[model samples]
Target chain A: MYRQPVSRLWWLKKRTYFVFVMRELSCIFVAWFAVFLMVMVFAIGRGEASYQRFMDWAASPVVVAINIVALAFLVLHTMTWFVLTAHATPIRVGGRRVLAMREARVAGRIVPAATAVRVGGRQVPAAMVIASQYAGLVVVSAFIAWLVLR
Target chain B: MTKRHIEPIVWLLFSAGGVAAAVFLPILILLFGLAIPLGWVRPDYNYLDAVVSHWLTRLVLLGLLVVMLFHSAHRFRYTLHDGLQLRWEVPIAVLSYGGALLGSAAALLIVLTI
Candidate 1:
């Protein structure tokens, strides 16, 4: 059973809800990673004494396990969460005409970069900007994992 | 083409993140398992920045958090709509804008506090 056709209680599905919660709230794990990074930065910025204390504090088994679990959750959540992005922004081609599934598929597959007169206003493709943002995110996330993992 | 397209860049950013998760998770889990007992991947390491003094590192952390935050918030907004089956633009608009605003504020707090 999916979300009911038209009722207010549709937003909450037990399974999807858990997955979304696991995914969305996994931001907390990323937050944990970021905070750890900030503290490390500040500690290093502060002094060797601070850095020593930081490592000593992190050496506890309980704390380490939590980060690991958080990392696992963060990874799973990120993948599943982003897959749903396609539903968020559907594209329409042509003037006031229905978007056929074939056209939608083609558009999604290829990176389109054309300035066309949209239904009401013209849409200019900013392909470069989008590319930069995604690249930045991937590089950044990967770099951090490398640092901590190493 | 006479058709307006959904910005492929958006999908690329989204799916790229997804793909990263796919590629990265196994490695993380493996490391976490390997490092868990050694005091390397500890819970408090979540606060590893306390020892780091790297500008590039902090910036990277910020980038990752911001991207993940926006990506999550944006997706969550739609999940609300699709799951709720809410057809009215007015309410959907309010919910999404409000959600984004709240999420952004929370992110700022997290960033600023520590």
Candidate 2:
């Protein structure tokens, strides 16, 4: 039996798929943050001097660049995951639901449009879902930014 | 218990960890990596030490480390399988999860001793 080789750039076929692959790719940065946390803990445990040294290392330009880049990816990861989570976690306010139909489509479940509407309760618009997602992201990112820059 | 039996529990941990990391980690990183370094907010060492050494704080820290590592393990395992197309499933799974367990243990010890 012969199997066709999947293209390396298969993800480029769709924007959603690309975003998903990027989401998976962002796990590396997540792990990097975990490692960074471990280092911080170890340094703090070693006392003030080591902690100061760790801070110095973290302050280096290269590290700052890395952190900035990591921050972007982390935001993407968080936003995408929340959107996916929103699909599973239904929230009703004033009898209105903000359903992420994109997630259902992403799952590749051949659900009828009517079924999707029924699942979400009155077909929440895609724009509304995206808007809410970005709104949440902005609030979160702002809080963190304030903590950092204030 | 079979693999299927344990998979759901592990996935639940991974999901919880992901949520926690998403909610908490960005702030921590910003504070330590940027704010402190850039002198935006100068928190004294004594204050930080006291906070880290507090029993409740250490417990919470330990919890975050453990679950975050588990999240890393699950994600890394799938990354290898799905992203890199690595066919060696068993070794990768064991190494990823085992490394996470060891990392959690080490973090626990460090927190306890601190």
RMSD of each: 10.8, 5.5
| TM-score of candidate 2 against the unseen true structure | 0.76
For all candidates in order, the CA lDDT equals: 0.47, 0.71
lDDT: which candidate is best?
Answer: 2
Q: Write the per-residue lDDT of candidate 1 for residues B1-114, one digit (tens) a residue.
A: 212453343334334434444334434444443354355565445344452325554454455444544444444444455444445745654554454356445545444544
How high is the TM-score of chain A in model 1? Answer: 0.50
Model 2: runs farther than 4 Å from truth? A1-3, A90-150
Error of 2 at B97 (Å): 1.4
TM-score of chain B of each: 0.48, 0.92
* TM-scores of chain A across candidates: 0.50, 0.61
